[model samples]
Target chain A: MSEKVLMKGNEALAEAAIRCGCTHFFGYPITPQTELSEYMAKQMPKRGGLYLQAESEIAAINMVLGAASAGVRVMTSSSSPGISLKCEGISYLIGSDLPCVIVNMQRGGPGLGGIQPAQSDYFQATRALGHGDGHAIVLAPATVQEVVNTTTLAFDLADIYRTPVMILGDGALGQMMEPIDFAEVPRRQCPAKDWACTGTGMKRPHNIVNSLYIQPEDLERLVEERFERYAKIEAEEALWEEQNTEDTELVLVAYGITARIAKSAMNMAREKGLKVGLVRPITLWPFPKKPLDKLSATAKRFLCVELSMGQMVEDVRLVVNGRAPVDFFGRTGGMLMTPAELLAQIEERMGK
Target chain B: MSADLSFLHSPRITLITGHYGTGKTNVAVNLALALRLSLSPIALADLDIVNPYFRSADARQALESAGVEVILPAYANTNVDVPSLPARVASVFDRPDLHAVLDVGGDDAGATALGQYASRLEECGYRMLAVINARRPEIARPEDAVAMLRAIEQASHLKVTGLINNTHLCEETTPQTVESSFQYADQCARLSGVPLVLTTAEERIAAQLQRPDLLPIRLYTKNYLERF
Candidate 1:
């Protein structure tokens, strides 16, 4: 048996990326996620990979774009504000049909919000990360081990879809310590990068990696094709976990660190004779609507808890679509909601 | 619940140092809380500037209520991620009567903050304890553990006088996990020439280990998903 090693979520994510053939890392330092860059800085050279600290987040993401266009597994990470700086490059990567991984250890904010953990970037990650009809595969893992698993799978998914993949972590998940086994990482077969911009030695035609389509009809055709891929991803890649939802009336919906807290709250409600369950979305972009759609028929109510002022609740409400009443309970501006506090929300929603 | 803390002997100042994610804050918090039972006016100075979360500031309410004075950075647990140190951290050196427990940051990056107080710590006579958790991949080997210990010493300009085996897999720790780490810790002590002072575990797991110097401690730091 492979020995389990304890690691912080950020460092574990970095190591997982390296283990899964991420040969290049371009990053800038930001709180709650700097350790990922720090780990890459220390270990990348030893593994014969490149780790460059770019001048800024913009420089780092464009560096990622450059590396990914050459058919190498590359990644960059940042906190909430830094991710905002990388959006234009991310859109370029999407428009050029490049594959890479971008990690956002989310902090509270519209602008320079607190460094403590917050999931306020749900809209940023799942909705308008880049200014176009484009969506990165946003994965939200609650535990450090899950952070590893998702990071390892992220590169593969990006390659499979030829799109940028975002590992949406929070400050708490980035800083917390947990045991993870690197030997247990699952590897998927990625499709060949035949359209890479690698120089041809007069053997094949030159490949052009550009996002600038001047003609409106040409841009529309490419975007429509990308949407077809997005449709396939939404149909096949929506991931979620259901706890006690088999016969529960009150179901709590959360993602990232908030989901972990809601799990504890659901257990406390269960012990007090209230039927409570939890729906945790592991993939935030795909949004895991199928299970919620199925549970909306039986569950009486759904409470969306987050570290933001009800961002993910909008998605939950839209998914439930009045099949059941969806309620919002949250704490914003870097404040964390404890299980006891969430239990009170559950009990109040259950009219107890 | 106390597992005979007689084997533990902290000087006027005890600085805890180790790699990141190796439970430095956990050990420092547990030691300060346990020592407060008999020692008077114990203060836990959070000198970690590297990590933003899971610092001693997170356990300030518990330690303060237990009569342990908690001194941390002003920006700790706040929205800002500034790496500035507080002026009150010097109170540990000013008050000679106070038994201060210093929780240094993880690895050499965090230890740079502790280097600022090296002169005062040397004059006052301090014992720096390096924590080792064998389950951590970076320091799983004895040589890597010793190298990390030496790196912490180089960064902080203070020598590690003792070693504490605080190895565990968080909530998944078992007697076998604690037992298996014994050789790793012992080898680290032998290589670094530092005495292996104490092996910490929960009271239940402490009862199972056959060691003379075991300090059974309750965990004060919590993972959000642990309750599940």
Candidate 2:
């Protein structure tokens, strides 16, 4: 039987990491998510686990890379600015095809932005992390329980794909307490770690996990192999949550905290005699493209609401392919469009 | 800002700010009530869009019963008539209503929305005060706190008039911390050229944390003050 306790998204994430057998966690502290580190700070030490609060995000994420190379489940976390610092490390992690977890309890940021909830990092997390031809499996979780659920999935997906994964969130979700059930993953679900360094011995002579490419041919082959793996990952793993999409006329595409708010707004829109629905992407990178393709056929229009101005809307338009009208409403720099505000957008979009 | 105006003007607008777990919202609510007793018309607008727990709105019904104006965004999608800004609230800011307090979300990004009311606030002569709880955020270091204040000021497009020192750990808060809070207030006053407006009192826990220089405090407990 599963026992549940009210936990913040961050705390739930910590529990998930433990259940995933992540014995090493390296991170620096940042706002809207100090609780995760605080919890880890207490629990990791007691469990004979390693929790190192590195000097900076760069150092912390690099530590994650080192631990993951040795085939131990590892993670690092930060809010926006700190995540910006982690970008260099993340690019390297992806380049090397190392498996690790990066939890960004997102706060507002262009530079040193406020510690309020924001979906602005969508663009940063998805694209433009270092100047690299690389991609991370980004998981956008909406609730506290999903925090644990997605985190466990992050570790699983990381090992399977040999890639880094990120769980994106905002301050509200990070700090708010909610009911959470703590359940152990089935032992059979644990990752098989054959390809890892694991201190290879005399039989293999030596094991190497390096992003370096001294020879041009080797580099080209490595890049092609990485892309091929990405292709397979994309084919197998893409998650989206659908609501009333079967015959829905209007669709609101959102994720993370905005998805929860959109869910509430969709409920209100229904009450106001409007047939509005939501399409929330759980996997931000392998961004559940099938639903977008399917919804484009039936849903007359789509509105992409985000904390950033129109970044995700761009993605929606791409998937939409002019099948229907696409609109946007957003609040950047730590702003949240209230339920009323979202409902207003829904009404206006419906031309009511 | 004039030195006297900063120090002596009625601190009509009490702006509460702090990290997530601090009692900033409760202090703001209690202070608003204290102001209601002293000043006729009072209002509390919860701008805590970022952090959802322990909001000033939790005490809205009690304050409303005491005839205090509470300005909140409209729940228009509820499909029923729910006032956005209550009549008393709209009226308070409209004319010579005495108290006007804003409970902004944590910091500047939350305060950024205050820019929309710059003209009206300037007309009504609202005072902005950044409340600090030194222990939380773990970086409630004076310099860091000052930076947060400057950011809040820039976002609101208004100068903060006074400093409110509300340093307390959860239930671990004590009178010693309250006394030390005065020192924090003094630093803020010197740095921003504002006065230490008020101190808080949890009547039950007062014996453990009493001080001579401290002002009468106002605190909130759900069971005690069923009606504000």
Best by DockQ: 1
Query: Candidate 1 local accuracy as lDDT?
Result: 0.90
lDDT (10s digit) by residue, model 1, range A1-352: 2888888899999999998999999999999899999999999999999999999999999999999999999999999999999999999999999999999998989899889889999998899888988999999998888898899889999999999999999988998888888878788889999999889989999999999999999999999999999999999988898899999898899988888899888888889999999899999989899889999999999999999998889999988999999999999888898899898888887889
Residue-level lDDT tens digits of model 2 in A89-117: 88889888889988999887789877667
User: In candidate 2, which residue pairs clash?
Assistant: B175-B209, B200-B217, B201-B217
For candidate 2, what is the DockQ? 0.03
Model 1's CAPRI class is: medium
The candidate 1 chain B region of ten consecutive residues with least summed lDDT is B1-10
The local lDDT score (0 to 100) that residue B142 gets in candidate 2 is 71
| lDDT by candidate, in order shown | 0.90, 0.73
Model 1: lDDT of residue A258: 88
lDDT of model 1, residue A72: 99
lDDT of 1 by residue, B1-228 (tens): 344654344458999999988888989999989989988889999999888878888788899999999998988878887899989988888887899889998998899998889999999889999999999888999999999999999999999999999999988899999999988988999899999988899777887877777888777775557433
lDDT of 1 at B88: 95
